[model samples]
Target: MTATPRPSESGLPIEPVYGPDALDGWDPDEKLGEPGSYPFTRGVYPSMYTGRPWTMRQYAGFGTAVESNARYKQLIANGTMGLSVAFDLPTQMGHDSDAPIAHGEVGKVGVAIDSIDDMRVLFDGIPLDQVSTSMTINAPGALLLLLYQLVGEEQGVPAEKLTGTIQNDVLKEYIARGTYIFPPKPSLRLIADIFKYCKAEIPKWNTISISGYHMAEAGASPAQEIAFTLADGIEYVRTAVAAGMDVDDFAPRLSFFFVARTTILEEVAKFRAARRIWARVMREEFGAENPKSLMLRFHTQTAGVQLTAQQPEVNLVRVAVQGLAAVLGGTQSLHTNSFDEAIALPTDKSARLALRTQQVLAYETDVTATVDPFAGSYVVEKMTDDVEAAALELMAKVEEMGGAVDAIERGFQKGEIERSAYRIAQETDSGERVVVGVNRYTIDVEEPYEPLRVDPAIEAQQAARLAELRADRDQAAVDAALAALKKAAEGADNVLHPMRDALKARATVGEVCNALREVWGTYVPTDAF
Candidate 1:
């Protein structure tokens, strides 16, 4: 007996099937090229994972500097190839741990790094020149970068030799995260200054990591996340070009950050589409001649939102699927979320298991031997094309309305994201979208999940150390460097150079932010925008 097929609201098959015909118009010569070639649709480098595998980097930082540093070393010993630091709310908000606004928040989510002294403790034994670091900071990126550079100096490693990434993507901060401190213009100025400083001084450092991870985490659909993120990237390039910097010089060092969701093939298609779209934007619209400018190298973190507090072990399977999607989609670096992530910060035991998942994939799976293994799949190709076309149409709408910055100011992107978010939430609520442990698979699963608990003693220790540093360092030198920093901010000068000087003189992150706050004031977002 022939069975009747169900239909979806979009008029597609309910259980949609795909075949070679799906890639009928997708040209091999035009779209799918060798790895490392122009457009970079396949992969970034020719060897791909054949020569060197993607870096296994798990995001781990919490509590005091010493605790985070210990965890870093532990992860390194466990074969973590790179370090990704997660700062506490106080650090992200540009406040000292002792500040009244910082109470109870210090060391709760991530490490509390208040000054250069804290920075020193954070990397006490780790060699600055050897290991690459990525700081997931945005609002206080300038101050953090300054401290990082000073750390390099103290370690006798010159700025030019330091290699790392600073999440200096401030635009998404306003739209999704709300971690922004300064107004848009002044924030852009700070980002530009970092771009300029790193271009001239720290050649190996990634000046900015334009991120869409938080956006997706905040409830954006995969399509809207990539589209809006690329829009912000284009706006940044335009702003940099207008700042009188050569496109090729700084563009290559620019990187991206993305989230790996559990939507297997859909996530893979989103990543592939993102690369092609970014390439076109850089070449066709921005007039970028360098192929490096067209390559969209990104770091991927498994979606934290997908983890469920109930049946947390199920999250391991989800993260594994998401991590596979990231690798197949060609991520340069990957961070697999821990199974216990939905409950609290991961314990050492849980973090190692998450890292081992990546290790097994890299070594045992043999997925790395081939580049773009699914490039010719009708399903993948068609989905990639569709996503690219949809994103481009949205981008054109943005262009007509003035550009990313203008659109952001008008809240167009924000409104669209919010709408999409609402749609997804409604779907989940109505049982149309299934979240296994949370919604579909009903069970009173009361497993005693182990969560890494940070003691309150961390804050007191950090505060005491901060006090000691203030008393020990030369107050006059700190005052003088801060004055210079304020003067530079008042002028057209790049603030990083003077800020680095202040960091080197033992000025705290709060002091440096306070000095700038006095000059540029602080950011306050209106409901309209």
Candidate 2:
């Protein structure tokens, strides 16, 4: 029998070669618009990277705030255009390092930031107005953002000048990641409050980064990734509009996050299809008039799940290829995962090399010399149409089930992604997937490598700091502020104002989250979903 044709990661069939008929009935006029125009399939901007390269952001954080701060300074010195922070479990989960629940986990995955004091140290010497930061925090995203603003005020930086993004996508947490704090109803309400607060207090801040990155890492194929992510984006827009806000007010500030895997062509098609779908949804469905409101501007990170730990150094090549795919796909910003990440936290040398990967893509490659380089290619155009059709079909299913939150309650997205993950696992086990260092190429005596390790003493030190903070601050003021925050959470008032007051009064991240938890309660997954 003839050899079977290989299939794409999304289970779509790939032809041996594509020609003119691949896009036989495609209409360029309606499908592909000029760059910076409607249906931004070409790109969201006219010049694209021809004017300036995409922002090179390095995601780094580990151990204490002081240690993580040093890494940030070093990255800036090494030519990083932006900073993306990674917080430890305790901070992301809204617990002080000293909490009984936080024991043995402080500073294990990322940096432990308990209060404004830690936030201040996290950006001590960095200029808030000059540098754009992206914090990877979900359920406790609001608290960390307020603390950052507090630090900016301490540094004399105006709120409007403070530019950054907070990964405030809690819906994904409920679906894939397990960091959700409140139930769906309360969580969406809190997100609406964030949109309102950012509009008034922090106009430059990205209110939420509706993410497909986590879902992809959890094994979602390209179609599932964008379908679920854009579905959530639509839900957020609907919630904001229902709360009496215009689409243009917050949509312009809205952004997205996605993963760029080694499959360059398909990833490029995915990005283009995503822009096209979002543009159509905003214009036709929502009647959004502003061009900015219709644009699907997103940041991309190289796929962390695709890296292999067997031959850790080989990951550098994987990251470089993945980063190239992101650039070719027209991402606004990018974070290149270091080669050592599959093993442990990136060593200083590996982190610099990761930044260098982007630098090479920018200065060394001619790929940035043009915009939408593969716009008219028959194969890419056909693949874009195919992915678009697949994603739209999934999106329609989500809509039929009453949108993202309802589908999520029914465990639709989660179950779909799990099936995809299982497929990949099975293929790997059968050796149908050729992972070079894993099954195909075997070497008996591999060289030893020492991975970077976080100091276990960090937990005790953070606990001591929390104790000292409690001793020095006025407990009554903090208590009253927390009580007010709880009252606001219990009522219809915007809670961030009181939450900010509590943070400004030296309230711990856990305390602020606890106040809301008392009112909204926490999210516990049920088997029925």
Candidate 3:
């Protein structure tokens, strides 16, 4: 290893070091107030992790429903606290495995969930009531959530008792991930319906996980990611409120998902700033009276972008550092990236090791004993303030463009993200960013590590199952459910109720979506460039 070059000091930057004097203008007692207090900058919970360590949720799902179910049980036995399900591109975009557009992608990246039958097999022997689940679905989130509700009913789990999060943030899908199915206004209307439905039926469930992970992965700065994500959350609240839902009812169930990147201190401060900003928005801006409404509970995943394709083992260290930053910043749950993630989905061994990393942190490190350990540190505090101010400024710009939806529609958000992404890529290409095995200390030859490979047989098996599902269920019932669902979409009824009924009648994801498409029509994105 050679000595690293000194980082640029000419730019306006935080001082290298500071003492008590660094907080001269800042009130330590007011800012660092107790955890679980009003304006919870320290944490949403007073005991922090002393009462319970953050839920260790490793995102896992691949191949067929049976395969994903077995893996979920395996993770639980290995001490995972929650199950985070990842769906294949087909399911994510509202196509069934057998759909023509889904041909080559079924069961490749994540689990293939087509109908209620697949949902049943996915939760086979696993009780939905006892274990919390998180689904990473966006455009077709309502369909998936309906399937989940049906699965819970099948397992004798009442709707009110079901607990979990659904990443139903379709607006971000359009701006960042490109998984949208409808235009912005209709998409937002569907989300409002879900918010209203969940508040009335599923009290413990999170209707939407306003996510910033995709934004970070799309090359937004930490400040932009935090700001834009919270801004979206506020927009959702406004949408729901405009639909006649109370802020306290839906707000408490709203949660956030963020990425913890390799910028250790920046990531930590970003989380802290996120909490403070969200709390203020809920109370001061939204006029929420409930403390839970102000609590910015979130699930953190280690930055997948930080993982390197070369010498992927280095990702283990990167993920560990990012995971630790998430814990220190007071995340309620975390997903550590597997060492082999850069190359592909993790092999079983690598995934287990990633889960173990969180276990070691919880048991070996005494860091959990103290809440917000760096809350008052000059560097952390200053960074938090800097990020909060910068994010608010960016948000004001977004507001001037008529808020997040308008910014996204005009391609402003995507353009900003592209600019940041290009700058970072330029830095990496110029060797200014040292990505260990990739840029610096380049390993000329690398040993190959086993990666998770999806078998072509899995797709065949899934298609067969889809055929069997169609054969076993009554076609009349399926047709009726779809008709009802379409009618609901065309009317003022909440779509989740009709969708859940359709799932119970064994309607496939594709069927439910197609029916709604008849009423709502499809979205055609204007040239964003």
lDDT of 1: 0.84
What TM-score quantifies how close candidate 2 is to the native fold? 0.98
Colliding residue pairs in candidate 3: none
lDDT of 1 by residue, 184-209 (tens): 78888888888898888888989899
Q: How does each model score on TM-score? A: 0.95, 0.98, 0.95
Better of 2 and 3 by TM-score: 2
True-structure Cα RMSD, model 3: 2.8
Maximum-TM-score candidate: 2
TM-score of 1: 0.95
For 1-529, candidate 3 gives per-residue lDDT tens digits of 5444333211115666657776678986666667997778899999999988998888899998989999999877766547899999988888888788888898888999988888889999988888888999987888887788888887889989888889999878866888888778878899999888887788788889999999889988888888789878878998999999889988988999999887777777888888988888899988999999999999999999989888887888998898998999899999999988878888888988998899888999998988888887888887788788888888888889888898887887788887888888998999987779888988878997667789778777878888998899989988988888888888888888878878888888888888877788777766544
Please name the candidate that would achieve the greatest lDDT relative to the true structure. Answer: 2
Clashing pairs in 2: none
Q: Distance from true position, residue 256, model 1, in Å?
A: 0.7
Task: Name the regions of candidate 1 deviating beyond 4 angstroms.
Answer: 1-15
Candidates ranked, most accurate by lDDT first: 2, 3, 1
lDDT of 2 by residue, 1-529 (tens): 5557568877787777888888888899889989889899999999999999998877789999999999889878866648889999999999999999999889988999999999999999998998989999989888999999999999999998989999999999987878888898889998999999999989999989999999999999999999999999999999999999999999999999999999998999999999999999999999899999999999999999999888888999999999998998899999999998888888889988998899999999999999999999987898899899999999999999999999998899999998899989999989999887888896776778899989999999999999999999999999999999999998999988999999999999988988889999998876442
Candidate 3 yields a Cα-based lDDT of 0.85
Off by over 4 Å in 3: 1-12, 527-529
Error of 3 at 425 (Å): 0.6
Worst 10 residues of 1 by lDDT: 6-15
